[model samples]
Target: MFLGDASTLLSVLNRRLPELGLVRYVCTETSWIESVLFWTDIRVGTSEIVLLQSNITVNYIKRKSDYVHEPISRTGLESIWRKMIELEILAMAFNPYEGMMAKISPTATPFPYRADNLWKIQSYVEDTRYGEKYFDGNFERSVEIKTRVGSGNFFRNEHSFPVKPYFNGQISKIASF
Candidate 1:
């Protein structure tokens, strides 16, 4: 069983990791709560394993997310709704990161953008082949445009610490080698 967008990875695994004997996979469109439950079941080894095989055709899907620091006005919401209707957008998922997320210390994690972020607005467009074009008018052939614009080049511009190597005490061994 897999969640979200795992098609490419699954394909590569089926080709390269044949020794694992992965026969079939179930990819389901799940709600946030359902996704949480599914992962929880897998982590706790409570998931039921059943052998089922069938071809699964997934609909065209596009996802765009943005962090919101302030509330939208009524007029702004109306305009957003009008644009969504024009584009035939399927759904909008609003996830609040304020309560539990804000409680976590910034120094505790490598993710640095959690402190001031209030909510995450995720827009989904599904079932339409031209969904990507309609979802964001700026992209002509790819979603890379949107990513670059939103990312602010943080990974490239900012000073980042070596996470895994340093944390695992393998930096010295790696450097020596």
Candidate 2:
């Protein structure tokens, strides 16, 4: 599935809706993996930044028949949300991939999550006759968002800012991510 900025996504979704052939879209909030976490351990002059990684998979079977279940009702949506949460928690707490980490990391070299790598191209300018144009125009391609956990500061790949400022409440590191 293509994941991108919301406004761009809305236009993309509108264009692709015809392909789905569904009369309507059942929009659902991200109840699982709700936010990306930028967890840090505080220190005097510096701190280490590590992005929290938790993954999960959800499978829903027919309760009675093969009909597609439309969770339009609050109760139905709640049930689905709860099931998603349960699966997410199970994966995070147990870390099912732990046992296979050694085998996968050393040998397989699986595709990595490159979301954080976007920081490498925070801002770019192209040569124009009149002046340089910002890649995102005047808008920031990425923006900082509060964590769903509502505690520590977290950032998604889209947000364009350095990681070090959030460490000591000071902008010691002016480097853009």
Candidate 3:
């Protein structure tokens, strides 16, 4: 899904995250794209004030001489993961939907420090091969680490957040490296 914001998000991740070993082995399949779409409401306690959010899925592929292969690398995939967190953190304050910074309410009140959009991870998987169960663990870890560091704004400009264990749910379903 080539939404208007897709390219912009991809660029941010590539430049900021770079190649690190943060990619979980779970996403090491051949180059693939995951599209995550959802809606979020910025509410006042329980009242819905406004709805705004973004869905970004990353495509992981290996880099070769003047060519890119679908086989994902640990470094390449990790970079994508790092980028996702970075984008989400920015999303808290910036509203891609409106092409402006996010507001605290629909009244156009400027958010103190960019509104923190309440987000949830639905799933990240290779739809062609396996179902939601395949990437469940890795997706969980990704959101956990992102939310943890985002909560503190830790190293916000860089992808240096800590990571947890590998998620290999039903190893039989994943493609071999």
Q: How high a TM-score does candidate 1 get?
A: 0.39
The C-alpha local distance difference test score for the whole of candidate 2 amounts to 0.29
TM-score of 3: 0.18
- Candidate 2 per-residue lDDT over residues 30-61, each given as its tens digit: 32233221122222233123222322211111
TM-score of each: 0.39, 0.17, 0.18
Q: Count the backbone clashes (under 3 Å) in each candidate.
A: 0, 4, 4
What is each predicted model's overall lDDT from 0 to 1? Answer: 0.47, 0.29, 0.34
Candidate 1 wrongly placed segments (more than 4 Å): 1-33, 36-47, 50-63, 123-177
Decreasing lDDT order of the candidates: 1, 3, 2
The per-prediction CA RMSD against the true structure, in angstroms, equals 19.4, 23.0, 18.8
Model 1, residue pairs in steric clash: none
Q: Is candidate 1 or 2 superior in TM-score?
A: 1
lDDT of 1 by residue, 59-157 (tens): 122345688888788898898878767765534656776655788887888865577788777654321235334556533333343232432333453
The stretch of ten residues in a row with the least summed lDDT in candidate 2 is 57-66
